[model samples]
Target: MAATLDGLITFFASHHAIRADKVLRDAGFATELASGPKELSPNCGTALRFELSRTDDALAVLADRHVQVDEVHPYVPRTDAWDRSGSPVRRAKRLWGRRS
Candidate 1:
Protein backbone atom coordinates (compact mmCIF):
# COMPACT_ATOMS: atom_id res chain seq x y z
CA MET A 1 0.00 0.00 0.00
CA ALA A 2 1.14 3.55 -0.56
CA ALA A 3 2.34 5.48 2.46
CA THR A 4 0.11 8.30 1.42
CA LEU A 5 -2.32 8.99 -1.39
CA ASP A 6 -1.64 12.58 -2.46
CA GLY A 7 -5.24 12.93 -3.56
CA LEU A 8 -8.38 10.90 -4.24
CA ILE A 9 -10.74 11.44 -7.15
CA THR A 10 -14.24 10.00 -6.78
CA PHE A 11 -16.65 9.70 -9.66
CA PHE A 12 -20.32 9.13 -10.29
CA ALA A 13 -19.45 6.18 -12.54
CA SER A 14 -16.60 3.79 -13.15
CA HIS A 15 -16.27 5.21 -16.65
CA HIS A 16 -15.01 8.48 -15.17
CA ALA A 17 -12.50 6.64 -13.01
CA ILE A 18 -11.19 4.70 -16.02
CA ARG A 19 -10.84 7.83 -18.10
CA ALA A 20 -9.23 9.74 -15.27
CA ASP A 21 -6.78 6.93 -14.72
CA LYS A 22 -5.63 7.09 -18.32
CA VAL A 23 -5.36 10.87 -18.38
CA LEU A 24 -3.51 11.10 -15.07
CA ARG A 25 -1.16 8.29 -15.95
CA ASP A 26 -0.41 9.75 -19.36
CA ALA A 27 0.35 13.07 -17.68
CA GLY A 28 3.03 11.39 -15.54
CA PHE A 29 1.07 11.32 -12.29
CA ALA A 30 1.25 8.33 -9.99
CA THR A 31 -2.24 6.86 -10.01
CA GLU A 32 -4.06 3.78 -8.77
CA LEU A 33 -7.50 2.23 -9.07
CA ALA A 34 -9.21 1.03 -5.91
CA SER A 35 -12.62 0.14 -4.56
CA GLY A 36 -14.44 3.28 -3.62
CA PRO A 37 -14.97 3.81 0.08
CA LYS A 38 -18.69 4.07 0.68
CA GLU A 39 -18.14 6.71 3.35
CA LEU A 40 -17.09 8.84 0.43
CA SER A 41 -19.30 8.54 -2.64
CA PRO A 42 -22.25 6.23 -3.24
CA ASN A 43 -22.05 6.29 -6.99
CA CYS A 44 -19.11 4.41 -8.43
CA GLY A 45 -17.43 1.20 -7.40
CA THR A 46 -13.97 2.46 -8.28
CA ALA A 47 -11.92 5.56 -7.53
CA LEU A 48 -8.60 7.08 -8.49
CA ARG A 49 -5.60 7.84 -6.35
CA PHE A 50 -3.16 10.53 -7.46
CA GLU A 51 -0.09 12.22 -6.16
CA LEU A 52 -1.28 14.83 -3.73
CA SER A 53 1.68 16.94 -4.74
CA ARG A 54 0.11 17.44 -8.15
CA THR A 55 -3.49 17.90 -7.02
CA ASP A 56 -3.83 21.19 -8.84
CA ASP A 57 -2.38 19.75 -12.00
CA ALA A 58 -4.62 16.70 -11.73
CA LEU A 59 -7.70 18.81 -11.27
CA ALA A 60 -6.72 20.94 -14.21
CA VAL A 61 -6.26 17.89 -16.38
CA LEU A 62 -9.65 16.51 -15.37
CA ALA A 63 -11.27 19.82 -16.20
CA ASP A 64 -9.55 19.88 -19.55
CA ARG A 65 -11.00 16.47 -20.31
CA HIS A 66 -14.43 17.53 -19.02
CA VAL A 67 -14.38 14.79 -16.44
CA GLN A 68 -16.50 15.18 -13.32
CA VAL A 69 -15.49 14.06 -9.86
CA ASP A 70 -17.89 13.63 -6.97
CA GLU A 71 -15.30 14.48 -4.34
CA VAL A 72 -11.61 14.44 -3.47
CA HIS A 73 -10.05 12.93 -0.38
CA PRO A 74 -6.62 12.37 1.13
CA TYR A 75 -6.24 8.68 1.88
CA VAL A 76 -3.49 6.27 2.84
CA PRO A 77 -4.14 2.58 3.24
CA ARG A 78 -2.36 0.45 5.81
CA THR A 79 0.93 -0.71 4.35
CA ASP A 80 0.72 -4.17 5.87
CA ALA A 81 -2.25 -6.48 5.52
CA TRP A 82 -1.87 -7.63 9.10
CA ASP A 83 -1.51 -5.36 12.09
CA ARG A 84 0.91 -5.75 15.00
CA SER A 85 -1.34 -8.38 16.57
CA GLY A 86 -2.00 -10.04 13.19
CA SER A 87 -5.35 -8.40 12.73
CA PRO A 88 -6.64 -6.76 9.57
CA VAL A 89 -7.96 -3.27 9.28
CA ARG A 90 -11.60 -3.10 10.32
CA ARG A 91 -13.85 -3.18 7.29
CA ALA A 92 -16.44 -0.50 7.04
CA LYS A 93 -20.07 -1.56 7.09
CA ARG A 94 -21.40 -1.96 3.57
CA LEU A 95 -24.69 -0.61 2.34
CA TRP A 96 -26.87 -2.78 0.17
CA GLY A 97 -28.84 -1.61 -2.82
CA ARG A 98 -30.72 -3.05 -5.75
CA ARG A 99 -27.60 -2.97 -7.88
CA SER A 100 -25.47 -5.18 -5.64
Candidate 2:
Protein backbone atom coordinates (compact mmCIF):
# COMPACT_ATOMS: atom_id res chain seq x y z
CA MET A 1 0.00 0.00 0.00
CA ALA A 2 1.12 3.55 -0.60
CA ALA A 3 2.04 5.62 2.37
CA THR A 4 -1.15 7.03 3.80
CA LEU A 5 0.44 9.78 5.84
CA ASP A 6 3.34 10.16 3.51
CA GLY A 7 5.55 13.20 3.09
CA LEU A 8 5.22 14.66 6.55
CA ILE A 9 7.12 17.88 7.10
CA THR A 10 8.35 18.97 10.51
CA PHE A 11 9.02 22.67 10.51
CA PHE A 12 11.02 24.79 12.93
CA ALA A 13 8.46 27.57 12.70
CA SER A 14 4.68 27.48 12.58
CA HIS A 15 4.56 30.26 10.01
CA HIS A 16 6.51 28.20 7.52
CA ALA A 17 4.30 25.21 8.08
CA ILE A 18 1.13 27.23 7.59
CA ARG A 19 2.37 28.97 4.50
CA ALA A 20 3.69 25.77 2.98
CA ASP A 21 0.33 24.11 3.40
CA LYS A 22 -1.40 26.92 1.53
CA VAL A 23 1.18 26.95 -1.21
CA LEU A 24 0.94 23.20 -1.73
CA ARG A 25 -2.82 23.25 -1.84
CA ASP A 26 -2.81 26.08 -4.34
CA ALA A 27 -0.46 24.02 -6.46
CA GLY A 28 -3.05 21.16 -6.45
CA PHE A 29 -1.43 18.94 -3.88
CA ALA A 30 -3.61 17.69 -1.09
CA THR A 31 -1.79 19.00 1.95
CA GLU A 32 -2.29 19.77 5.60
CA LEU A 33 -0.38 21.39 8.42
CA ALA A 34 -1.05 20.50 12.03
CA SER A 35 0.27 20.79 15.51
CA GLY A 36 3.41 18.64 15.55
CA PRO A 37 3.04 15.87 18.07
CA LYS A 38 5.17 16.75 21.09
CA GLU A 39 6.93 13.43 20.64
CA LEU A 40 8.01 14.47 17.14
CA SER A 41 9.10 18.06 17.75
CA PRO A 42 9.46 19.92 20.99
CA ASN A 43 10.67 23.14 19.43
CA CYS A 44 7.80 23.50 16.99
CA GLY A 45 4.07 22.91 17.27
CA THR A 46 3.32 22.88 13.55
CA ALA A 47 4.10 20.50 10.69
CA LEU A 48 2.90 19.62 7.21
CA ARG A 49 2.03 16.30 5.61
CA PHE A 50 1.40 15.44 1.97
CA GLU A 51 1.52 12.60 -0.51
CA LEU A 52 4.73 10.68 -0.02
CA SER A 53 5.33 10.31 -3.74
CA ARG A 54 5.49 14.06 -4.00
CA THR A 55 8.27 14.53 -1.48
CA ASP A 56 10.71 16.07 -3.92
CA ASP A 57 8.06 18.21 -5.55
CA ALA A 58 6.78 19.32 -2.18
CA LEU A 59 10.21 20.40 -1.02
CA ALA A 60 10.82 22.27 -4.24
CA VAL A 61 7.52 24.06 -3.97
CA LEU A 62 8.16 25.06 -0.37
CA ALA A 63 11.57 26.41 -1.24
CA ASP A 64 10.13 28.36 -4.15
CA ARG A 65 7.58 29.86 -1.80
CA HIS A 66 10.32 31.00 0.55
CA VAL A 67 9.13 28.80 3.40
CA GLN A 68 11.95 27.73 5.66
CA VAL A 69 11.10 24.21 6.73
CA ASP A 70 13.24 22.71 9.46
CA GLU A 71 12.79 19.00 8.76
CA VAL A 72 10.61 16.42 7.07
CA HIS A 73 9.38 13.14 8.47
CA PRO A 74 7.18 10.24 7.45
CA TYR A 75 4.30 11.04 9.78
CA VAL A 76 0.72 9.89 10.01
CA PRO A 77 -1.28 11.52 12.71
CA ARG A 78 -3.17 9.11 14.97
CA THR A 79 -6.52 10.59 14.16
CA ASP A 80 -7.99 12.36 11.13
CA ALA A 81 -11.00 13.78 12.93
CA TRP A 82 -10.94 17.39 13.96
CA ASP A 83 -12.93 19.18 16.63
CA ARG A 84 -14.41 22.19 14.90
CA SER A 85 -15.83 23.25 18.22
CA GLY A 86 -13.11 25.25 19.80
CA SER A 87 -11.31 23.57 22.64
CA PRO A 88 -12.80 24.55 25.93
CA VAL A 89 -10.93 27.17 27.91
CA ARG A 90 -11.38 25.07 31.03
CA ARG A 91 -9.32 22.32 29.49
CA ALA A 92 -6.51 24.75 28.81
CA LYS A 93 -6.63 26.06 32.36
CA ARG A 94 -6.62 22.58 33.85
CA LEU A 95 -3.81 21.35 31.63
CA TRP A 96 -1.61 24.41 31.81
CA GLY A 97 1.95 23.55 32.85
CA ARG A 98 0.92 19.89 33.05
CA ARG A 99 2.62 18.98 29.80
CA SER A 100 6.15 17.72 29.84
Name the best candidate (by TM-score): 1
lDDT against the true structure, per candidate, is: 0.78, 0.74
Task: Return the TM-score for each candidate structure.
Answer: 0.70, 0.67
lDDT of 1 by residue, 31-98 (tens): 99988876678898899987777788999999998888888888656455534532344322222233
Clashes of 1: 1
Candidate 2 per-residue C-alpha lDDT over 7-37 given as tens digits, one digit per residue, 9 for 90 to 100: 6788877887888889988998888767786
- Candidate 2: where are CA atoms >4 Å away? 1-3, 79-100
Positional deviation of residue 94's Cα in model 2 after best superposition, in angstroms: 30
Positional deviation of 14 in candidate 1, in angstroms?
Answer: 0.4
Clashes of 2: 0
Clashing pairs in 2: none
